[model samples]
Target: MPRNRPLAAVLTTVVLATLTAAVTTAVTTAPVAAGTAGPKTVIANLFEWNWPSVGAECGASLGPRGYGYVQVSPPQEHVRGQEWWVAYQPVSYRIESRKGTRAQFQSMVIACHAAGVKVIVDAVVNHMANTDKSGPGWAGSAWTHYDYPGTYQVQDFHHCGRNGNDDIVNYNDRYEVQNCELANLADLDTGAAYVRDRLAGYLNDLLSLGVDGFRMDASKHMPAADIAALRSRLSRPVYIVQEVIYGAGEPIGPLEYTGNGDVHEFRYGKDLARVFRDERLAYLNNFGEGWGYIPSNVANVFVDNHDTQRDVPGTLTYRDNGIYALANAFMLAWPYGSPTVMSSYEFTDRNQGPPSDSAGRTNNSTCYSGGWRCEHRWPVIANMVGFRNAVAGTGVVNWYDNGWQHIAFGRGSAGYISINDEDFAVTGRSYRTNMPAGRYCDVIHGEKSGSGCTGPVVTVDSGGWFRADIAAHDAVAIHAGARIS
Candidate 1:
């Protein structure tokens, strides 16, 4: 499922339209597990981008654009492979993975921190490399099955021998899922105190480096009790977003993990895709618990991720630009789960590594290439980051829908957005924009370019209504950040 396509243009736009293209964005710090009480900003999963690219852009690009954090690839030693998932199978906590070396990683963190972009790394604590032969890892750490040179021994691993070889078979049984190896990856005995100490040491090593949070990978595979215990061992309250996919008949649910931190709402992307694609806009009035995606505070939402982009159906990817952009607008505008923007490369093969050199290091010539696709750079998506931040604590008031495809809503009195999902244009009609009598920049399509608007200019009267025409598959979003009129 790797998409091999030329990278599109670097997405560009400004909310106020005052800054140049390479402007330094003054990033606003936000909390994780976003809700109405969520982070003031959002996260960008820089899938497989190297430390140099990450460090370089922190000040020049991301911070200026108002991103709260960047969830980077696993920055630990692992099996050397061109496939993406190999990073998840760690060899050591050496800070020398495919992304960068130890010094480069530290420098990147310092740079991002200086830019006000918190770094949340993907922490893989569930297992080790799924290898048959013993060899040195990317960081030159040697290890055999459950036996590293100076670390874990054979006793450190679990012996949940399902299918007679420790490979997980019965996912319905919670024990096999947690204790047994996943896809031949060696399962760690997380219940052991010694193992917990070792895990904490690695995590503390990262914490010492000023990492603000962690995205716990395959969190469901580890028992909730163990995760809580692991959190207890942490030195501080680092933001945690557990990766737990709640699918059919899964016994260990996200509710069990919420006591510690947020859980990624895997269903959000799939659900929204279906809702908007079928023109089921009116049914979303009760979008949070009414649609069963509730307990808003602990939910981390996204349109798609590195995993779902290739495999899961009904996810809005880069391929479907119009509908995908609409879904992203709704995600940012909606006040439910805390949203994380997905930034990935263009690929037809799902497992293809990022654009890199022969040694598998990132080729960071352009911010994106035929190999890299930075979705967060898109004007609509990037500006929405500012919009969400602008309307952070506000409630979704002035909800409007045609009882069919078209819809509009106000985030308190701070921001307003309208979507015309119908095939035909809605012309010569007045819509309740819920704004004061003034001129505002429609940031969905463009930005303010000085005293002028690059997108469209909407004139609102005293009654909070505007006579406007909206096209098919397009939306209009305006917030306090870009309001000139």
Candidate 2:
């Protein structure tokens, strides 16, 4: 049941204005602290895997790897395997999905938190379960298009005639996107009083469970004003990221959700993929505004997402090669939107589930075992995670470039990095790093016997400059805290 419309609407407005104003005031008044840098680079996309698996995987992989957060798949109750999109067809605000039981979900959340990694659940509140579908969900809830007897029923859905077409043809038309069905999924009347109460209850539940934020799916498919309304009713400072995939000239782009939260900068991944893989390395220095990108702080950058990995063609070509290393390395090194590194399991067919048994129980793919390849476990990618963590809050100072295929930059005085992707060896280039005089460890290619680092000491003199050679097809990162500097 929905809540009172007029009152809910008024409350929502007040919340949005207060939260937005508070954040704005903080940004304006707070001076930059010495070590309190800008954003950090540690984000992970949790595919549609179960809770136990997520906990086990994050504990074993991401937790130890020092990822700042893990963006888990939708946790709402949904139709079970009517199609993969069934998850998009949310049935109710229950923590029971294909992932795991409520207890398991809570355990995963606790485990991730204990490991110093935050959890961001993929929220699908824009609409509800698709109409006319009948199936039992992970929570044993049965749903139908027009009727949900004794379970969950929303009578205010748009009439059948209104959503006759499949694609949303009008970008400027806000109502059609917000009130219309997405991919034939049921549309909820968010303005309804009962609906607002239920949705807010669900969000509050997640917050109580120690979840950090949300990655709103198909955000463009909803009305920005309504989203703003929904966000306001929640507690202050909930990290919200919207998925609005747009290219250069798309009329309805991410700007619509500017004040709401960070919008997914799909263009960054596409452009970075091309430049890092096929083009010369010199093209990297002229990043950020040179490539016509949104400011780094307001964007959520990724190399590939679930939709693009499965649907978009030509976006991801080198999922198994050195190009992946170079592309991800550049994303971590460069100042961009909050970066999210994808951790995928190898699959011959796009729709195939994670490594599973004959009875359909999902299981982990071993690193040494030849069944699946977990890209996050790769040495190059994992090492870069450490580099990004070490250089947190530093500006890109002392950028050096030997034309294309050779580039270098330092992050505030904390860390310095250089890369060479050319076919031949590149050397004899140096830059000012601004660190104290002493030797520091190069995170990449250095020895890591214990939990910390050792080897490849970089000596930054009193002049704040150092000389280093960049090997072909490889990258190097040096930090201040590891070695005496």
Candidate 3:
């Protein structure tokens, strides 16, 4: 769900103002899971992309680039508005919104599956539309604040009689955080069996239509036990990643929800940004557990998501340009957590939705032409997907950093990468890795073409040493999968 303005201010100031250390001393990294149906664990968050655009991207880019999953914004019918947050304010579970009609959404799923990519929906189950407004939803379903004709009723919500408006004001109190409204949006009584069944039914509907998984939105507002009950109601097991923002000293943290499934490691993007902008890139050598984040296996990490791109202060967004690409390159090269590459559209206003018609139907995305900033398609980010897949199950080795903005590392003998964030070029440096001797494409700058590369190529000698000059804020990555000879 997109962050609400009023609530965003509170969350930015109170909950996420401080970057705290990891809450638990968990395992460093979980062993990579055995092969599954999808290509890999890399997810492309195509936020606000229409269903047709999503389907086309599957065949045109996602499949070719080795993306395992694509997470779409909430597909349910939403309030009538051009603001992006309206998608988060559900009026009904109908699969009709500015994104597309239900048929179009189903087609997108089929196309993605055909392309060997799984679909993960951003499921908004914690609340309904803001109680203040009432009208026909996007799908023509008449809905009031707490009442949907064929879905939920007033009793399905939690009228937490705290703060005058019932909106969450105290992050320290677990009960208030879970039961109170978030930005005055009607909070669902998730603990209630009836409400849980309704939410599960909506998710099951998506599964029936071939959705492979779900990104549980606003999971922090629901107790872990309640979420488990909702999961139990699922028709079958589907991949689940819950959004449990880790607030410092908060009673309920992201770790508590790991039992349910993978949790969004919010700290990753923030800490990563801090290192890229203010701290040293060498510090990323001890990025994950050393930085006190959640266990790598059950953590879902991203450089910047839709919300953080606008609301969070410390993270990097598309505006960072080449430096942002370098950050993503490092993320893909580093075996930290399951990485999600965020593909966003240009937005001058926080509430501005994707490019849409007068009636609010989203237009087809014209990458790099219209508002779409297809970051996932960027050379450094897209090509690195293959690098990540090639280095799967391999641990970091031959790590090196210049004690500041330059760092290099290898994943066993499968892949190697060196990122230089210094203001000037670091020339004539020979970086040693465990990769086999061969002519490999420098995936960061150019992709592998037939028998060669389109950009600068790096040759590793028999002794596993590669000599190259890295430019300021640039990177060079070579993987076994892209070896030319």
lDDT of each: 0.78, 0.66, 0.85
Top-down lDDT ranking: 3, 1, 2
- The TM-score between candidate 2 and the true structure equals 0.82
> How far does residue 102 in candidate 1 sit from its true spot (Å)?
1.3
lDDT of 2 at 37: 27
RMSD of each: 5.9, 13.3, 9.0
Candidate 2: tens digits of C-alpha lDDT, residues 33-58: 11112333478776666688677766
Cα lDDT of model 3 by residue, 290-392, tens digit: 8899999999999999899996568898877766777888898898899999999999998899999887899997777578778887767877888999899
1-485 per-residue lDDT for model 1 (tens digits): 12122211211121213112211232232212112222455898888888988887776657767788888989989887778887888888899987888888889999999877899999999888887434688878987778876778889999885698998888789988999998888889999999999999999999998889999999999999898999999999999999998867778788888998999988888878778765467777878767776488899999999888886466888666666767888898998888888878777787787877898776662544556657777667777787898788888887888877788898877789888766556788776755677887887766665676776888778898877787655678887666776
lDDT of 2: 0.66
Q: Please report how far candidate 2 places residue 484 from its true position, in Å.
A: 5.3
Q: Which segments of model 1 are wrong by more than 4 Å? A: 1-39, 132-134
Best by TM-score: 3
Candidate 2 at 17: error in angstroms? 52
lDDT of 1: 0.78
